[model samples]
Target: MLPINRAVSRGLFAGLALKAGSSTDVAWARACYAIRFQSTSTHLTDASNRIRRRRKKPAFLDRTPFPPSPEEAVNNILYNTPNATPAPVTRHVLNCLVSNEPGVLSHVSGILAGRGFNIESLVVAKTEVPDLSRMTIVLNGQNVVIEQAKKQLEDMVPVWAVLDYTHGRIVERELLLAKVSTVPHEHLSEFVEHEIEGQEVEEPESRTSFSPLLGTALQRQAITELARLFGARVVDVSLDGVILELSAKPDRVDAFLKLLKPYGIVEAARSGAMAMPRSPVDGVFEDEASLEVEDDSGKVDATMLPPG
Candidate 1:
């Protein structure tokens, strides 16, 4: 028993001594090396896993209503007009000839604001005759909402005429004024070269003229011709002028200016479009001048329009 107990004690003590030594410098060195090695391996594994997960996840645009396929994403921006369906933002211009009464303008504007039509711009000026005034208003909304707004304006007592300039065969124009920054060689050349981005030229020509594209009775033919011959772009076409914001090549726009030299150019500005539909009836408003409104409740009256 004594021998056995001694053997057990010796073994236990030796094991303890070994364990104690292991916890000191030698054990500490091994422990540190093991931890460092494991840490490096763990980090590398974690990084590889993260890369794989990222590769599997979809892009930000994939969550949209209409996700662009591989082909669409490559060719067009994900948020381009064609890719993104536009909400119903129908634009309209309204031309009115109202009696120059004190509260007439207020009533017209109030009707629009009350019904929640977003008026982009409103201009009111007295006509050549002191008793009458001309008002131009731009607004946007749903087609139904606009129709309701128009009906409300026409129903008002003082409104002589409320013409939806959108359809009228009249000259319409919107002015754009932009004070773009110009620092020497900074963005000046880029800014000077292009204000709006979408421009492509077919052929180069030498020309410098600012001719207002005339919107005459035969303007459709002229526009078609111009588009065919010079590859002129029709930015917008209204009764007034066919807005040709040259998107062709730089040399092409320059050549267009040369071709337009013989024709006179009107005002030019930088920005999006602001146009009004104009008609040749501007000079012959005598019959329209004498138009008398007979209010037929709950119905649109056409006797108010300018006669040709």
Candidate 2:
């Protein structure tokens, strides 16, 4: 893991020192080579330190300088006491800033696959800014694996930053689009969509009057009431029934689905949890910036915006 310059100098020193010569001549030659290598290695190490100090800082919480020399990282690990036990496996969400180009994703994904890491979920999309894309990956592994993945990602020329969201406080969310075959048309409540708009799930929603003229008004009204309870909204209604959309924690979504099963679930799509580290302030969702993105296709991809 020596720097390239140091490695080259060592190789030259070894080659020069191995040459046959008279006893005195050999001693002088070895001494000269040793001195030369030392000087070269020192200069190279200093240059490496300068480069590392100038390495772009990741937006992540850690501000530690990138390793000045790869050898130093190895030495640190070799001399450091090992943890009592290998870190237990845990889920981690990693966000990587990468140049928008072909094969970058394949290169990154290949590295993890080669290392036998399991990627539970992965999302790749352009960011709000131009050219730079964000790769959000969810993996389950020990702390050591996570560290290896981050280092590997940082090594790639196209990667600008790799932030381990799980290691720090973060704002996390998941989205779900579920289609159910039942529309609570029984209750004459006009519709739940009107109520779902412009409201946070936490805030109380006043009951909209059910349309008395609608058939099965009471049943439909009850269904609308329950949908509101589960923080669901009718995104679309047609012959297939109703499309309910919601965003919440995974477990909450599970509960919501379980309750809606009697309504006949036709299909569902969920965006695996996306996360970003919280700011220095409190963990309030409002304290963080949203990650809404729109590509050249004119399609808005809402990974995780502020939940309201």
Candidate 3:
């Protein structure tokens, strides 16, 4: 079959479209024309021939070889914490830009699954345009495995870019939504008054006494007030409790939960860290600190992270 270049293929299709009203019809005529007229086999065959005839991979002066895998020294032990033994494995986050098409995620995940790397957390969402998406993937692995994974990801067609934000100084944040309890509108003021600590009270009046249901209401009221102080927004309310949502640094939010321990916590959910590099100003870094494992060699050691 003869090969059809872009100009010839488009010209041929244009002629077929003009004859759509004919008895043969567009679909049938188009299929016949495609089978008989438009061909790319010869062009592909020539390209394959050129590739086979090439002697060796081209070399450029600036080409840098991929880093070789390193072997551990006899006393290469590092500590994750001051007293902790046997440092934990490192985790890396890859931000992937991909075409918004079906099976793209499956293909990306399949590669990770095959490599035996554990995915700590993954968030996939569409971008400003419907035809593109960003996949933020967190995975645990050795340095060698991490580099190899990046190389493989770059080779896939659907993947447009894979930027690693693991070792860099990055800004990361997470979201938390909690279902907390609160008192009904009626007993709010009394519930609020009793929560104040060291309030010496004499024998109470009849109205001061709280019933069984009111006791639960008091507990819920304390919880709600605490949530409010943490800048949490009330999302939903019911006869029992309210659903509150908040966004904060992960560690600070963890501390907030510890403060809520006095009140009964019903439910909570958290998202994995969403991270990006801090903006640079005049070629200087605005954010300076980075989390690192302290090592004698002053190299990148696995800084153990608390499990999600």
Candidate 4:
């Protein structure tokens, strides 16, 4: 079909030819129509070619390789370095002071979870200031990972401050409560004798009647002595078991648990570590400005920390 402009032009030219009444005029009209049609067709063809070119992919795309998958890309960037060895992971203790509000713990934990970190132990409780709370987090990670975690935690709105006491001379302690069997194990007999430092008394035939009671008394004595050596106390005593309580450093708590293992620990609970830096002087507290400066420097003043 002819375009409107072409149809109108054709009609006008034909009318002129009829008025002129000459074969030359008619042929001229036909020639002009053909020229217009050819030009239109050429213009339409060029436009269609341009559209097709625009739709085609770029030449570089054909030569360029597809991007690596997310997992592969991460591996290449983080793990595929030349002569790179894995960073050594060590335990880190981070103390965060946060506002005492609901869901604060969940928010902090969610951040760590999103970053793919596992919290070994977490202890949260109200600080001396009623409006603020202290959260102690224990985790094992490379130094870089821990530092990144600290930065992220510090960025949180509820987190007022983050203190890393892993390398600092802080007084850290954990509480352990273990329910151990009152009946002593045979293996612990030698240990008991060594710890108690008293020889057993031989009894006559008539006195042998009290042997069972004597054995029970000796067992209690052994347990009590072990507790005293570790600065623990027997908090509860029952016919079958005794609850021992110990508040000490994490390593000492572990050692105490190991010592009680032979006696059949029925149940045990340990409060995750809580820590504070030693006071520089008696009854004097370090202010927030000094704490901030220490945090920025990543070092605790040796003079501020009391020597052992």
After superposition, candidate 2 runs with Cα above 4 Å error? 1-87, 183-223, 282-308
- Weakest 10 consecutive residues, lDDT, candidate 3? 287-296
lDDT values for all models: 0.58, 0.72, 0.72, 0.81
Output the better candidate (2/3) by TM-score: 3
How many clashing pairs does model 4 include?
0
Residue 167's lDDT within candidate 1 is 59
- Candidates by TM-score, descending order: 4, 3, 2, 1
Q: lDDT per residue, candidate 4, 48-135, as tens digits?
A: 9999988967565466688999999989878766786989989999999999999999999998887788898899999889999999
Worst 10 residues of 4 by lDDT: 186-195
Q: RMSD for each model, in Å, please?
A: 24.5, 33.7, 33.2, 19.9
Candidate 3 is scored at a TM of 0.52
TM-score of each: 0.34, 0.50, 0.52, 0.57
Candidate 1 displacement at residue 82 in angstroms: 25
The candidate maximizing TM-score is 4
Model 1, 1-308: lDDT tens digits are: 23434444544554555567755455544544445555557668999999998886665675457776989887675456475555677777778878888998788888888988767777787889998988888778877777888888788777788777675554444433211111222333443344356442222243452112222324445444655586545566543345555444334545665554333344444322234453435564434544522233446668987887
lDDT of 2: 0.72
Expressed as tens digits, the lDDT of each residue in 30-121 for candidate 3 is 65556434355556778899988896867767777765445333234432236646445798878899999999999999999989988877
What's the distance in Å from true for residue 60, model 1? 61
